[model samples]
Target chain A: MEDTGTRSFVERLLQLDRRWIFLGIALAVVVPFLVPGFKMRSGVVSPRTQSIYDTINGLPAQSVVMFAFDYGPASIPEMQPMAVALCKHAMSRDLRVIGVAIHPQGPLLGGQALREAAEEYGKQDGVDYVNLGYKPGGAAAIKGIGTNIYKVFPTDLSGRNSATLAVMQGVRTYDNIDFIVALSSTPAPFSWIAFAHEAYGAKMGVGVTAVMATDFYPYLQTDQIVGLINGLKGAAEYEDLIRHPSYGMLGMSAQSVAHLWIILTVIIGNIAFFMWRARTRG
Target chain B: MEPGEAVATGMYYLSGPVIGTGVAVLLTLAIYSFLYADNPVYKFAEHLFVGVSAAYGVAITYHMAVLPLIIDPLFRPQNTPSGQPQYWVIIPALLGLMMFSRFFRRYDWMSRWPIAFMMGIGAGLAIPATVQTSLLPHLYSTMQPLAPMAEGRLDLLTGIDNLLLLVGVVCVLIYFYFSLEHKGVFGVASRVGIWFLMIAFGAGFGNTVMARISLLIGRVQFLRFDVPEIFFPPSP
Candidate 1:
């Protein structure tokens, strides 16, 4: 009977090797990058990335901005694009940037972003930017920085006295910072909101991984954070807002393709399941 | 090599693109072999990653934290203007040293003091801030205009959104209210709350999927574009 044939087909579909799906995903991602003249159009700008852009754009030239690269190598794929976009935007505005990290790999990643931006803008390291580097202790160190940065970060990443850096001449604590942006993969942003933002009344912005994005929505509504950029979509939106198409924008096309593939797989799976159920009922 | 570059002249070869890209590609492929089956290649890559991260973490902790926070400050002349030592840092220094007592079976109880002190301070610091920033503000935001008036006039779309949000919040809260029995209208409302919860969870899952795919795309791009450009630069 047709019912038996249909049931067998559905069963086979259900039992298909998962490796095939993995291969599908691989193709979905790789084809976009390898294709000649493949240009990915920028995605629609979300309000979060827009807010981040507006906040940075509205800042005065030479304003001191603090960027906390609170992430590691594992998070580089997601967080790095946002960092690059932020550094580029801040540097373009002639803003003086002070970079720090609570996580060990943060300083290295932060330094990479600053160096890339600085080179593009022909900006001097000591004068235009300084990387204070990784300080141990999570929330406590954040509180310490807000209170007395000199005591917390005695020296910069390269062992130069932090006080000697031209960028750090008058900038001491959170009060001196115009804006504090925490680019994080963990709960460090919430710690910033709790310790630094609450105590010092520091204007905070956050760029968190997508998985952690929705949990911070309440803070955004409450105006506890001025701006938020979540995941690669946020990074792409930021790059689009800044009118510079970079890595984030470039990756969007492949992301779209992969999403479509996943959605299709889900739809097929549901249909097969329902078909199998109908056959059993008969 | 440039004189002012971060890499030392003797170790310049270590920073070359070939070694970096080769290692990256090999490790990525090895990890991706898990899609086929669990094998020694994947396990080797996994163990290597764990080992390197642990080693790096220890080195960074000592260099960044212990050197500056404890060793340098206590030894540096400027920290103690007079010949006498600055005893202020000694309190924290002693507490930090106590944390290492966990290594010895007999002395493990001593480590509890530092752990307790840290937790106590952390709780004391976080509670007030959480209440002010997270709790109160969240409650305030959730209590938005139920009718969603725009410019002293009623707007249909805004009103619908506000009404849905209000209903969702109320229903969800009601569902969690243990005092109320699941009977009559309460049961219906709780059922509706389940739908709203499902929708929120679905949204979160969608976002999670998007994030994962983004990561996959990044790795593929690295293999395709990043490594090629680094190892085999196009002629000018």
Candidate 2:
């Protein structure tokens, strides 16, 4: 009779200490950042990131744009730069920006972006941009904006009423609001498009984590959403689109090396599997 | 620094003898300890992540939901024409409040409306967007020719890609549709569909691993580059 167990080598391979795998993954990442030599030439810009640029770029000077800071600190590395770049670009164009957050911390993050960008572009706080901070309603807040933008966001980051400002006067609803850019780690962007865009035909933009991109592609294809900045890759793509370089590129180069490591590991694992299989079969 | 700002970031920089190495090594070991067996250290970190995230979520909801709706319209109203209440919204708002009462067990059913609304709306938003964003565009994108497109003419490469995508997608769709039995052409089609699914999964896995590795790189950059001030100051 043929030996049935055959040392159950594949099982042992399967049972191989997972700690080693974790360590390998850790090193696979850690080594790349410590040293330098990796570089990235701008690959072809995906249409997704470009449309966002074009949409923001195309708007007239002092166009009123509302952007959300929806992610937390963990997501800052991937998301904050896109928010900053877009804020900087918009402020540079003299776009009147309204910073809001579905996330509570959004006011802080969004305020910081507007302030930094304002300083860089020499924009006045109330004149160039306004940080609406965090609002009360979830999706309902978005729907409310269809009727009254001021009612939804009555105050700035501070307690001051929005009606007191020049920026808030003509902006009644989503109709007057030139563009809606939502930066979310969660599902906020989709809701904004659904509630506000569907209800009021607000021009919509979304920047989200990459894993969510596959889900958003249908919206992109339908032309319901004008642009997408997905994951860090999408952020990197956006950085390329802006002609300003930052962390996205560093992340990309590290990512490229790590990818190559995994590919090699897979190849080696496959070879070992095939060899073990053939010996047992013989 | 502001009152809310966290300066420590859990990092304690010190001179000589790998002072942080104790914690760094312990944390690394603790995180990795989950693989060998589940223990207190692993549990601690996991709980810490969950607790911090939950606190953030609760705080956000307080501002984003409670303060704005129940607190604002009821007590503190701003930006009103006459400083009066938008009292009509209180009905649905009350219904929304009934949701948190689920923890009381007896009042659990009240939460159904809010939960159902969330689910129903999420599904509602997702379904239409899915068709508009994912299904149609992917169908169009995949139809491109494997080679190149002719200028001012029908893009040949697109057409070829379209053919492959069409065949693959249709077969994959058929695999899910249990209206008919798997037989003859259907069996073959479903098998071919598996191949397309496998290829897609492989690519997804590759990209996903790359993404995860990048996240790990960020953590490492913090450890080696950010923490070690004795060796290096901030890169400027």
Highest lDDT: give the candidate number.
1
Off by over 4 Å in 2: A1-16, A36-42, B1-38, B78-82, B85-93, B105-154, B224-236
**Location of the lowest summed lDDT over 10 successive residues in candidate 1 chain B:** B3-12
Clashes of each: 0, 17
Residue A136 shift from truth in candidate 2, angstroms: 5.3
Model 1 agreement with the true structure over B95-150: per-residue lDDT tens digits? 99899999999998999999999999889888987898798888887776756677
Candidate 2 true-interface contact recovery: 0.29
Interface Cα RMSD for all candidates? 2.5, 3.9
> Compared with the true structure, what per-residue lDDT tens digits does model 1 show for residues A1-282?
886787889999988888889999989889988888776665578887788889999999999999999999887778999999999999999999999999888998999999999999998888999999998788888999887898788778887778878988788888899999999998899999988888889999999988889888878888999888989989988888877888888888888888889999999989998988887786
Per-residue alpha-carbon lDDT of candidate 2 for residues A21-105, written as tens digits (9 for 90 to 100) = 6667666666667677756454677888899999999999878998888877666666777788888878877888888887777
RMSD versus native structure for model 1? 3.4
Per-candidate local distance difference test: 0.86, 0.73
